[model samples]
Target: MISHCVFIRFRPEISRARRDALFAEIDALRHTLIGIVAVYTGVNVSPEIGMDKGFAEGFIVDFDNAGSRDAYLMDPGHQKTGARLVAAAVGGGNGILVYDLDTGHCLVRQAR
Candidate 1:
């Protein structure tokens, strides 16, 4: 199995309504994309010190393998939905992070 984890930090100027809409749009992907075994997303509310709470929204998606992950990345629904969500949610370049689970290493990559 492969896990695609994403951390999204909202633009401080974004309204609550927009944030909620972004969350809803993200949730809608579960039904629109094939090869997604499971999808979970939510706001980060941890109180841990020095923790980058800048990342307010995040999601974890489980797939059968890397091929499924790649498909999800290129899926038309994902592209359309993601553009809408990011255009509304992100503030700048530092607002997102992505990680991929491998055999023993969690490879971090740019969230493009």
Candidate 2:
């Protein structure tokens, strides 16, 4: 299993409505892509100090395997979406942080 995590710090000028719309667009990809187990998106709401840096929004994409995650990364739909995300971010591509975790175990717990 693979967990694709992304943190985004959008430009200060971007309105809340626009940010919500972008998240909606990202959520829509679950239907178009293959091997996507789940999609989660939201804005950071933590009150803790200095934890988030400048990233205000984030998303997690669960995939069945590394191949599936890699395919999603190369898909044209993802490319388009990513381009839009980068355009709205603070420093173009530099404003986003991405991490992929290889879950050695199944993402879901098995029944006893």
Candidate 3:
């Protein structure tokens, strides 16, 4: 299995209420998309101490393999969720980082 992770930073103008709504929408994708083995999302709790950049939200999705990850990229529900994320939560430029996990070595490396 491969863990597909994405960290998202919301726009400065976006309100906390809007961000919560976006989080809800993202959580729904787990039920909508078929290829996802598991999905998890959360807000950054320790922005002041841990990260200087104030990244807002993040997602961790487990897939059976690389092919499932590719399929998820093209899935309509996933695409719709992304559009909603951009329109409702992140109004300005968004920050994202993706990674792939190797369960055997317990290591995560940036996905190409």
Candidate 4:
């Protein structure tokens, strides 16, 4: 299994309604795309001050494997959705951070 995580710092001009609508579109992709195990989206709610670093929203996408994750990256629907996200993000693409983890067994040592 693979977990794809994305965090976003949205531009100040983007409204809450717009953000919700964008997430809705992303959530809809789960049904249309193959190999997607699940999709989770939410706002940051940490009580610790200065931890979020302005990244107010995020999402997690679970895929069956690396191939599935690769396919999702190439999907047209994802491309469109990603474009919208980039546009609304602060400093364009700089405002988004993505991390992917392979949850399956590993033989190699984990990177530092």
Each model's TM-score, in the order given?
Answer: 0.75, 0.87, 0.68, 0.90
**Given candidate 3, what's the lDDT at residue 74?**
88
Provide C-alpha RMSD values for all models, in order.
Answer: 6.5, 3.4, 5.4, 3.9
lDDT of each: 0.74, 0.89, 0.70, 0.92
- The all-Cα superposition gives candidate 4 an RMSD in Å to the true structure of 3.9
Clashing pairs in 3: none
Off by over 4 Å in 3: 46-52, 87-94, 104-112
lDDT of 2 at 60: 91
Q: Which whole-number lDDT from 0 to 100 does residue 98 have in model 2?
A: 97
What's the CA error at residue 55 for candidate 1, in Å?
1.4
Determine which window of 10 residues in candidate 4 has minimal summed lDDT: 101-110
Off by over 4 Å in 1: 89-91, 103-112
Model 1 C-alpha lDDT per residue in residues 1-112, reported as the tens digit of each score? 7888878777677787877776677667778777778888787768885586567677888887888889889988777767765665566445678888753255668788
Q: Model 2, which residues run further than 4 Å from truth? A: 105-112
Which one wins on lDDT? 4
